[model samples]
Target: MRREQVLVFDADDTLWENNVVFERVIAQFLGWLDHPALGLPERRAVLDEIQAANAVTHGYGSGMLIRSFADCATRLRGRPVTAAETAEIAALAAVLIDHQVELVPGAADTLARLGVRHRLLLLTKGDAEEQRRKIDASGLAPYFQALEIVPEKDDAAYRRLITAYGLDPAESWMIGNSPKSDILPARRAGMNAVFIPHAHTWVLEHGEVDASDPGVLHLGALTELVDHF
Candidate 1:
């Protein structure tokens, strides 16, 4: 007998253009930097270092990114940052948070099709309020049976979600672009995972997926998911 399957989806890069927004914001922030001695690479390195440290306390979101920009600017300048500079960074955060939510090519169509045959859940990691804002704006909420905005996605998180939802791991499928967050953790939690690689995946989310992992499936695009279901 075929088991009833629950399909879980990741919100950010998997369904929409998320990381590119951050990339653009970082570029603009770098352009505003007063320190010309620091090249783009050096500035980015500083930003990444600060963001990583902030992630532990701040988690993830535009707010964390905004704080990172402020911290990076101060560190690079070797002096207190000006109010004008801080405001500029704040404006970048505003742009990021207010940016229109555009779905990845064929994301809506694929979700529509899959939603009809399977119980679909949106499982994403980020600041709850910010994630909710994106979900509300994306117009993809109706397709999901539930929306889970978590602080992090790990094996423990996946296990908790599976248990809370009363989902059979053997009959569940987790789909997303991140190997670290979506693929590895879900697979570790005993669910099947489908990895749809994204061109602009965040650096922190990068991880290797073992080809030999029986629970893992790799696809080239969101549209290809229709063929699987």
Candidate 2:
């Protein structure tokens, strides 16, 4: 393998505990849903229904989580919930949103090390506003040469980044946690792919694969790539 010039990194779970926060908040709401007055089965039923119905639309976001909980509360109570109760539920999520940002273990040191030799860029997907907020709070922003927040990551996004940077995919590597969003598409674009597993990954991000993908590489964590370099 030739030395790569660009080291594109994914922002969310790759660098920090992202989806876990959402999962934790949702768990709290679920615990509330299991109140004796609500019944365990009924609570699960409501949550399952909401997720099934909203799976394609809202996906995962603060707004979707908030609305799903609000809808579930109304359904369980058989009437609209009071503003105070709604506020309380939303407050749990609010705290998560406002909480101090933290990087995954070794994230900063690894990035700082890699940034010295590679042209580092942060490529992430999701709500642009929220992503920016996380980036700002993370203090990982300065290490990257540039940052991008897109709705979808595909060949077009890859091409745009390459074009913008005047880079050759042959000499650039996409390093991220998601198989769907980072590895597979990047390989298809003729870019080398480095997969660094995270503790949490979304259901849709999983992809079927075999060992023949020469451009694809896997590491235990982001910091592990220092050895590869």
Candidate 3:
């Protein structure tokens, strides 16, 4: 049980819910897409297909979702949609995108407790503006010394953080929700990982692993983080 130095945390599902809002927006889009001529199931199928394809290219974001909807609308309408129509679609997106930061239960308390001793850093991946907006609105920004908003959480991300912070991987811990993004990669980098599961995690964030490793740990809630160390 070597003493820990730096503790990095993921921002999205780790601190708050992200994909749940996406799911709500997708549902709203599906309802709007359905008409007398277009069946809901058929429209949903097309959306799913487009989203699957878009995941390969855009990864994840409101922009990608809106673009996919615009593309689908164009194919169905047989005519170019007006700017007004695009605005309507994007307006539906705004409801979720404009949402205030709703922290996961106990996130603030846990972070406050942990901030007392460890060097805390936020390591997350998402659109720069949106991620920053959420961080700012969450009122939790002050807890972290810095943030590393990356495109992907991989071995490279871990190496970069270690180098940037001048930290020993063995003495640093990565606390996050996604096993794919946080646990496996951190373990591979020889850092301890603490996984706090969120109910509505994105599918792409899933990855295979044995959580029994000394370097890997899982918790049910964010507050459990304080006890792990």
Candidate 4:
């Protein structure tokens, strides 16, 4: 019998249009902030800096993002953010949390086809509730054998999943848009990776993809999976 292979997928920009929604919210936040001396580019730079710093301390998700926005606004104003202003920011930020999850085209059909032949797992990093909410809303959760939501994805995290699922690294592949979180870490864990780049992937998730790596597979879209595997 052929050895059973496992395919681990990333949820964000891989399965759905995640970062674009965040971009929309960021645009709204920047417009609302409207710093006296800063243009849109300058304001975005400041917010990105704050988000990078706050991500480690406060973690990811819409809530932490809005918190960073508030902090950025406070810094821009050079004064304590008033409660009224905070409330307004929160109101404007609600769409970030409640926005409908947009699944990538053919994602569900691709996953369904793959799931029939190989075990499928979802490996997404974010706030638990926020990630789960998206998974549920996408109607793609049923395609995965197990859905994993973690604070981060790294070599260690991939190894943990390997051990937990009794997966053989040689027969496993990480599929996603993130070279940083998905491809690199899975390669480090002795597993293969499938890279599907997304145009609007978050800046923080950007990293170098070594196309020379023999274990790496590059594909254009989810529908292309059937021909290769």
Assess candidate 2 and give its lDDT. 0.80
TM agreement with the true structure for every prediction: 0.95, 0.82, 0.85, 0.96
Per-residue CA lDDT of model 4 for 92-205, tens digit only, reads 889888889888999989988788788999999989999999999999988888989989898899999999999999999999999889999999999999999999989888
What root-mean-square deviation over C-alphas does model 1 reach? 1.5
Give me the runs in candidate 1 sitting further than 4 Å from their true place.
1-3, 34-36
lDDT of 1 by residue, 1-229 (tens): 2335799999999988899999999898988885768888888888999999999899999999999999998899887779988887898778887899989999899999888788999999989999999998999999999999999999999999998999999889999999989999899889999999998998888899999988888899989987877
Which one wins by lDDT: 1 or 3? 1
Please provide, for model 2 over 1-229, each residue's C-alpha lDDT reduced to its tens digit, 9 standing for 90 to 100.
Answer: 4354889998878988787787678778888665656666668667768754664576545776687888888887778978997888888789666867778889999988888877899998766888899999999999998999986788888888888888788889999888888988888888898888776776456676445778888788777888887
Model 4 sits at a Cα RMSD from the real structure of 1.4
Instruction: Please give the range of 10 consecutive residues that has the lowest summed lDDT in model 3.
Output: 1-10
Q: Which 10-residue window in model 2 sums to the lowest lDDT?
A: 52-61
In the order shown, the candidates' Cα RMSDs to the true structure are 1.5, 3.3, 2.8, 1.4
lDDT of 1: 0.90
